[model samples]
Target chain A: ADLQQGRAKANACAVCHGQNGLASHPEAPNLAGQPIIYVTQQLKNYKTGRRTNEIMSVIAKPLSEQDIDDLALWYSSMQVEVKMAN
Target chain B: ADLQQGRAKANACAVCHGQNGLASHPEAPNLAGQPIIYVTQQLKNYKTGRRTNEIMSVIAKPLSEQDIDDLALWYSSMQVEVKMAN
Candidate 1:
Protein backbone atom coordinates (compact mmCIF):
# COMPACT_ATOMS: atom_id res chain seq x y z
CA ALA A 1 0.00 0.00 0.00
CA ASP A 2 2.99 2.26 -0.32
CA LEU A 3 2.07 4.64 -3.12
CA GLN A 4 5.63 5.40 -4.20
CA GLN A 5 6.72 1.76 -4.32
CA GLY A 6 3.45 0.71 -5.87
CA ARG A 7 3.91 3.18 -8.71
CA ALA A 8 7.41 1.93 -9.38
CA LYS A 9 6.31 -1.69 -9.37
CA ALA A 10 3.44 -1.00 -11.75
CA ASN A 11 5.59 -0.07 -14.76
CA ALA A 12 5.32 -3.45 -16.41
CA CYS A 13 1.59 -3.42 -15.83
CA ALA A 14 1.36 -0.03 -17.54
CA VAL A 15 2.70 -1.58 -20.72
CA CYS A 16 -0.68 -3.33 -21.07
CA HIS A 17 -3.06 -1.84 -18.51
CA GLY A 18 -2.13 1.71 -19.50
CA GLN A 19 -0.25 4.24 -17.47
CA ASN A 20 -3.17 4.56 -15.10
CA GLY A 21 -4.88 1.12 -15.35
CA LEU A 22 -7.33 2.15 -18.10
CA ALA A 23 -6.06 -0.65 -20.36
CA SER A 24 -4.14 0.28 -23.46
CA HIS A 25 -5.34 -2.88 -25.15
CA PRO A 26 -8.90 -3.92 -25.98
CA GLU A 27 -8.43 -7.29 -24.32
CA ALA A 28 -7.12 -6.02 -21.01
CA PRO A 29 -9.54 -5.08 -18.28
CA ASN A 30 -9.53 -1.54 -16.97
CA LEU A 31 -8.14 -1.93 -13.49
CA ALA A 32 -8.51 1.64 -12.35
CA GLY A 33 -10.43 1.95 -9.12
CA GLN A 34 -11.31 -1.74 -9.00
CA PRO A 35 -11.80 -3.06 -5.49
CA ILE A 36 -8.52 -4.00 -3.83
CA ILE A 37 -9.86 -7.42 -2.89
CA TYR A 38 -10.94 -8.11 -6.46
CA VAL A 39 -7.67 -7.09 -8.05
CA THR A 40 -5.63 -8.91 -5.43
CA GLN A 41 -7.62 -12.11 -5.86
CA GLN A 42 -7.20 -12.10 -9.65
CA LEU A 43 -3.42 -11.93 -9.55
CA LYS A 44 -3.45 -14.69 -6.96
CA ASN A 45 -5.71 -16.71 -9.22
CA TYR A 46 -3.29 -16.33 -12.12
CA LYS A 47 -0.34 -17.15 -9.94
CA THR A 48 -2.02 -20.25 -8.61
CA GLY A 49 -3.21 -21.33 -12.07
CA ARG A 50 -6.83 -21.16 -11.04
CA ARG A 51 -7.22 -18.72 -13.92
CA THR A 52 -4.91 -18.79 -16.88
CA ASN A 53 -4.25 -16.25 -19.55
CA GLU A 54 -1.31 -16.55 -21.89
CA ILE A 55 0.42 -13.40 -20.75
CA MET A 56 -1.06 -12.98 -17.29
CA SER A 57 -0.13 -16.46 -16.18
CA VAL A 58 3.42 -15.77 -17.19
CA ILE A 59 3.52 -12.28 -15.72
CA ALA A 60 1.97 -13.40 -12.48
CA LYS A 61 4.27 -16.35 -12.07
CA PRO A 62 7.06 -14.43 -10.41
CA LEU A 63 5.05 -12.06 -8.24
CA SER A 64 5.49 -12.49 -4.51
CA GLU A 65 2.62 -11.81 -2.15
CA GLN A 66 3.92 -8.31 -1.47
CA ASP A 67 4.38 -7.56 -5.17
CA ILE A 68 0.81 -8.56 -5.83
CA ASP A 69 -0.45 -6.38 -3.03
CA ASP A 70 1.55 -3.42 -4.26
CA LEU A 71 0.24 -3.82 -7.79
CA ALA A 72 -3.32 -4.07 -6.54
CA LEU A 73 -2.85 -0.98 -4.42
CA TRP A 74 -1.39 0.92 -7.34
CA TYR A 75 -4.32 0.14 -9.56
CA SER A 76 -6.94 0.67 -6.85
CA SER A 77 -5.58 4.10 -6.10
CA MET A 78 -6.38 5.25 -9.64
CA GLN A 79 -9.76 6.84 -10.41
CA VAL A 80 -12.30 5.84 -13.04
CA GLU A 81 -15.64 7.15 -14.30
CA VAL A 82 -17.89 4.79 -16.22
CA LYS A 83 -19.88 6.17 -19.11
CA MET A 84 -22.54 3.75 -20.29
CA ALA A 85 -22.02 2.29 -23.73
CA ASN A 86 -23.98 4.18 -26.34
CA ALA B 1 -26.40 -23.25 -13.58
CA ASP B 2 -29.37 -23.02 -15.96
CA LEU B 3 -27.81 -21.79 -19.17
CA GLN B 4 -31.09 -20.89 -20.87
CA GLN B 5 -32.39 -18.87 -17.99
CA GLY B 6 -29.03 -17.23 -17.60
CA ARG B 7 -28.95 -16.21 -21.23
CA ALA B 8 -32.47 -14.83 -21.02
CA LYS B 9 -31.62 -12.71 -18.02
CA ALA B 10 -28.44 -11.43 -19.62
CA ASN B 11 -30.33 -9.43 -22.23
CA ALA B 12 -30.08 -6.35 -20.08
CA CYS B 13 -26.35 -6.80 -19.74
CA ALA B 14 -25.88 -7.22 -23.51
CA VAL B 15 -26.42 -3.55 -24.20
CA CYS B 16 -23.06 -2.86 -22.60
CA HIS B 17 -21.29 -6.17 -21.91
CA GLY B 18 -21.92 -7.51 -25.44
CA GLN B 19 -23.77 -10.69 -26.33
CA ASN B 20 -21.19 -13.15 -25.04
CA GLY B 21 -19.79 -10.93 -22.26
CA LEU B 22 -17.05 -9.45 -24.45
CA ALA B 23 -17.90 -5.94 -23.49
CA SER B 24 -19.11 -3.51 -26.12
CA HIS B 25 -17.58 -0.62 -24.22
CA PRO B 26 -14.03 0.12 -23.19
CA GLU B 27 -15.18 0.97 -19.71
CA ALA B 28 -16.85 -2.39 -19.25
CA PRO B 29 -14.77 -5.42 -18.40
CA ASN B 30 -14.95 -8.50 -20.62
CA LEU B 31 -16.80 -11.09 -18.60
CA ALA B 32 -16.52 -13.97 -21.02
CA GLY B 33 -14.66 -16.94 -19.57
CA GLN B 34 -14.33 -15.18 -16.25
CA PRO B 35 -14.69 -17.51 -13.26
CA ILE B 36 -18.20 -17.84 -11.86
CA ILE B 37 -16.97 -17.09 -8.34
CA TYR B 38 -15.43 -13.80 -9.47
CA VAL B 39 -18.42 -12.58 -11.40
CA THR B 40 -20.87 -13.62 -8.70
CA GLN B 41 -18.84 -11.88 -5.99
CA GLN B 42 -18.68 -8.65 -7.95
CA LEU B 43 -22.43 -8.54 -8.45
CA LYS B 44 -22.96 -9.23 -4.79
CA ASN B 45 -20.58 -6.43 -3.94
CA TYR B 46 -22.57 -4.04 -6.08
CA LYS B 47 -25.80 -5.26 -4.52
CA THR B 48 -24.69 -4.89 -0.92
CA GLY B 49 -23.10 -1.48 -1.42
CA ARG B 50 -19.65 -2.91 -0.87
CA ARG B 51 -18.93 -1.57 -4.34
CA THR B 52 -20.74 1.19 -6.17
CA ASN B 53 -20.94 2.43 -9.70
CA GLU B 54 -23.50 4.84 -11.06
CA ILE B 55 -25.21 2.35 -13.34
CA MET B 56 -24.24 -1.00 -11.83
CA SER B 57 -25.30 -0.13 -8.30
CA VAL B 58 -28.76 0.67 -9.59
CA ILE B 59 -28.85 -2.34 -11.90
CA ALA B 60 -27.80 -4.66 -9.11
CA LYS B 61 -30.28 -3.19 -6.64
CA PRO B 62 -33.24 -5.25 -7.81
CA LEU B 63 -31.43 -8.50 -8.57
CA SER B 64 -32.35 -11.50 -6.47
CA GLU B 65 -29.57 -13.86 -5.42
CA GLN B 66 -30.81 -16.33 -8.01
CA ASP B 67 -30.70 -13.64 -10.65
CA ILE B 68 -27.09 -12.85 -9.81
CA ASP B 69 -26.09 -16.52 -9.99
CA ASP B 70 -27.84 -16.93 -13.31
CA LEU B 71 -26.18 -13.89 -14.80
CA ALA B 72 -22.78 -14.97 -13.57
CA LEU B 73 -23.27 -18.40 -15.07
CA TRP B 74 -24.25 -16.94 -18.42
CA TYR B 75 -21.11 -14.86 -18.61
CA SER B 76 -18.84 -17.60 -17.30
CA SER B 77 -20.15 -19.98 -19.92
CA MET B 78 -18.86 -17.75 -22.71
CA GLN B 79 -15.26 -18.15 -23.93
CA VAL B 80 -12.39 -15.69 -24.39
CA GLU B 81 -8.94 -15.89 -25.93
CA VAL B 82 -6.45 -13.13 -25.31
CA LYS B 83 -3.73 -12.17 -27.78
CA MET B 84 -1.95 -9.84 -25.42
CA ALA B 85 -0.84 -6.22 -25.87
CA ASN B 86 1.57 -5.39 -28.62
Candidate 2:
Protein backbone atom coordinates (compact mmCIF):
# COMPACT_ATOMS: atom_id res chain seq x y z
CA ALA A 1 0.00 0.00 0.00
CA ASP A 2 1.24 3.46 -0.90
CA LEU A 3 1.72 5.44 2.30
CA GLN A 4 0.83 8.71 0.62
CA GLN A 5 -2.23 7.16 -0.95
CA GLY A 6 -3.19 5.76 2.40
CA ARG A 7 -2.79 9.19 3.93
CA ALA A 8 -5.01 10.65 1.24
CA LYS A 9 -7.60 7.98 1.85
CA ALA A 10 -7.46 8.80 5.52
CA ASN A 11 -8.86 12.30 5.00
CA ALA A 12 -12.38 11.00 5.42
CA CYS A 13 -11.42 9.69 8.82
CA ALA A 14 -10.30 13.06 10.16
CA VAL A 15 -13.69 14.25 11.28
CA CYS A 16 -13.67 11.76 14.11
CA HIS A 17 -10.15 10.45 14.15
CA GLY A 18 -7.91 13.47 13.67
CA GLN A 19 -5.86 14.13 10.54
CA ASN A 20 -3.06 12.09 12.06
CA GLY A 21 -5.27 9.47 13.80
CA LEU A 22 -5.83 11.16 17.13
CA ALA A 23 -9.59 11.24 17.49
CA SER A 24 -11.50 14.52 17.36
CA HIS A 25 -14.36 13.03 19.30
CA PRO A 26 -14.39 11.04 22.48
CA GLU A 27 -16.47 8.39 20.79
CA ALA A 28 -13.83 7.60 18.17
CA PRO A 29 -10.64 5.67 18.89
CA ASN A 30 -7.10 6.78 18.14
CA LEU A 31 -5.70 4.72 15.30
CA ALA A 32 -2.12 6.00 15.44
CA GLY A 33 0.46 3.39 16.31
CA GLN A 34 -2.01 0.56 16.68
CA PRO A 35 -0.75 -2.79 15.49
CA ILE A 36 -1.58 -3.16 11.81
CA ILE A 37 -2.98 -6.62 12.42
CA TYR A 38 -5.29 -5.30 15.09
CA VAL A 39 -6.47 -2.45 12.93
CA THR A 40 -7.04 -4.75 9.96
CA GLN A 41 -8.93 -7.24 12.04
CA GLN A 42 -11.24 -4.64 13.53
CA LEU A 43 -12.08 -3.20 10.14
CA LYS A 44 -12.84 -6.66 8.89
CA ASN A 45 -14.90 -7.34 11.98
CA TYR A 46 -16.93 -4.19 11.44
CA LYS A 47 -17.39 -5.03 7.79
CA THR A 48 -18.44 -8.57 8.62
CA GLY A 49 -20.72 -7.72 11.55
CA ARG A 50 -18.64 -9.71 13.97
CA ARG A 51 -18.31 -6.39 15.77
CA THR A 52 -20.84 -3.61 15.45
CA ASN A 53 -20.60 0.15 15.58
CA GLU A 54 -23.00 2.42 13.75
CA ILE A 55 -20.41 4.64 12.08
CA MET A 56 -17.56 2.16 11.79
CA SER A 57 -19.81 -0.46 10.21
CA VAL A 58 -20.87 1.96 7.51
CA ILE A 59 -17.34 3.17 6.90
CA ALA A 60 -15.86 -0.31 6.78
CA LYS A 61 -18.59 -1.71 4.55
CA PRO A 62 -17.45 0.01 1.38
CA LEU A 63 -13.74 -0.51 1.89
CA SER A 64 -12.11 -3.18 -0.26
CA GLU A 65 -9.50 -5.50 1.23
CA GLN A 66 -6.70 -3.41 -0.21
CA ASP A 67 -8.26 -0.27 1.13
CA ILE A 68 -8.42 -1.84 4.54
CA ASP A 69 -4.79 -2.85 4.35
CA ASP A 70 -3.71 0.58 3.21
CA LEU A 71 -5.62 2.30 5.96
CA ALA A 72 -4.34 -0.01 8.63
CA LEU A 73 -0.79 0.41 7.47
CA TRP A 74 -1.09 4.15 7.31
CA TYR A 75 -2.50 4.55 10.78
CA SER A 76 -0.26 2.03 12.41
CA SER A 77 2.81 3.78 11.08
CA MET A 78 1.96 7.14 12.58
CA GLN A 79 3.32 8.10 16.02
CA VAL A 80 1.14 9.07 18.97
CA GLU A 81 2.16 11.04 22.04
CA VAL A 82 0.07 11.85 25.08
CA LYS A 83 0.94 15.12 26.83
CA MET A 84 -0.21 16.25 30.21
CA ALA A 85 -2.52 19.26 30.43
CA ASN A 86 -0.62 22.29 31.65
CA ALA B 1 -18.54 15.60 41.63
CA ASP B 2 -15.02 15.82 42.95
CA LEU B 3 -12.37 15.91 40.22
CA GLN B 4 -9.84 14.06 42.35
CA GLN B 5 -12.38 11.40 43.20
CA GLY B 6 -13.21 11.16 39.52
CA ARG B 7 -9.57 10.70 38.65
CA ALA B 8 -9.26 7.99 41.25
CA LYS B 9 -12.31 6.23 39.93
CA ALA B 10 -10.97 6.44 36.39
CA ASN B 11 -8.17 3.96 37.19
CA ALA B 12 -10.26 1.03 35.96
CA CYS B 13 -10.49 2.76 32.59
CA ALA B 14 -6.69 3.04 32.30
CA VAL B 15 -6.23 -0.49 30.96
CA CYS B 16 -7.81 0.51 27.66
CA HIS B 17 -7.68 4.28 27.84
CA GLY B 18 -4.23 5.25 29.11
CA GLN B 19 -3.70 6.54 32.60
CA ASN B 20 -4.02 10.10 31.37
CA GLY B 21 -6.85 9.45 28.92
CA LEU B 22 -4.96 8.60 25.72
CA ALA B 23 -5.94 5.09 24.72
CA SER B 24 -3.53 2.20 25.00
CA HIS B 25 -5.43 0.38 22.28
CA PRO B 26 -6.91 1.47 18.98
CA GLU B 27 -10.16 -0.09 20.11
CA ALA B 28 -10.60 2.48 22.85
CA PRO B 29 -10.88 6.25 22.39
CA ASN B 30 -8.91 9.07 24.03
CA LEU B 31 -11.32 10.54 26.50
CA ALA B 32 -9.21 13.53 27.46
CA GLY B 33 -10.76 16.91 26.74
CA GLN B 34 -14.03 15.58 25.36
CA PRO B 35 -17.16 17.56 26.09
CA ILE B 36 -18.48 16.28 29.38
CA ILE B 37 -21.95 16.11 27.95
CA TYR B 38 -20.76 13.90 25.12
CA VAL B 39 -18.87 11.61 27.44
CA THR B 40 -21.73 11.43 29.87
CA GLN B 41 -24.21 10.74 27.12
CA GLN B 42 -22.16 7.95 25.61
CA LEU B 43 -21.74 6.26 28.96
CA LYS B 44 -25.48 6.49 29.50
CA ASN B 45 -26.09 5.14 26.05
CA TYR B 46 -23.86 2.19 26.75
CA LYS B 47 -25.54 1.67 30.07
CA THR B 48 -28.96 1.81 28.44
CA GLY B 49 -28.14 -0.21 25.31
CA ARG B 50 -28.46 2.75 22.97
CA ARG B 51 -24.87 2.08 21.96
CA THR B 52 -23.16 -1.26 22.11
CA ASN B 53 -19.56 -2.35 22.49
CA GLU B 54 -18.49 -5.65 24.01
CA ILE B 55 -16.14 -3.96 26.41
CA MET B 56 -17.80 -0.62 27.06
CA SER B 57 -21.15 -2.20 27.72
CA VAL B 58 -19.66 -4.51 30.28
CA ILE B 59 -17.70 -1.73 31.95
CA ALA B 60 -20.66 0.61 32.06
CA LYS B 61 -23.14 -1.92 33.38
CA PRO B 62 -22.29 -1.50 37.02
CA LEU B 63 -21.80 2.26 37.13
CA SER B 64 -24.08 4.53 39.11
CA GLU B 65 -25.10 7.99 37.93
CA GLN B 66 -22.46 9.53 40.15
CA ASP B 67 -19.84 7.21 38.82
CA ILE B 68 -20.73 8.20 35.30
CA ASP B 69 -20.68 11.89 36.11
CA ASP B 70 -17.37 11.69 37.89
CA LEU B 71 -15.79 9.80 35.06
CA ALA B 72 -17.10 12.22 32.49
CA LEU B 73 -15.77 15.14 34.46
CA TRP B 74 -12.41 13.53 34.97
CA TYR B 75 -11.89 12.64 31.34
CA SER B 76 -13.29 15.83 29.98
CA SER B 77 -11.02 17.84 32.21
CA MET B 78 -7.94 16.15 30.74
CA GLN B 79 -5.93 17.68 27.90
CA VAL B 80 -4.98 15.86 24.70
CA GLU B 81 -2.47 16.75 22.05
CA VAL B 82 -1.82 14.98 18.72
CA LYS B 83 1.61 15.38 17.19
CA MET B 84 2.82 14.28 13.79
CA ALA B 85 5.42 11.54 13.52
CA ASN B 86 8.95 12.77 12.99
DockQ of 1: 0.06
True contacts kept of each: 0.00, 0.31
Task: List pairs with backbone clashes in candidate 2.
Answer: none
Candidate 2 residue B70 C-alpha distance from true site, Å:
2.0
Question: TM-score per candidate, in order?
Answer: 0.53, 0.70
Query: Candidate 1 residues A1-86, lDDT tens each?
Result: 66677778889888877776655665566666655776788888789986667799999999999999988777667644333222
Name model 2 segments beyond 4 Å from true.
Answer: A22-42, A50-55, B24-30, B33-38, B50-55
For candidate 1, the lDDT comes to 0.72
lDDT of 1 by residue, B32-75 (tens): 65567767877887899765667889999999999998887776
TM-score of the A chain in candidate 1: the value is 0.92
lDDT of 2 by residue, B19-84 (tens): 977667866765666667778887998899776778989999999999999998897776555555
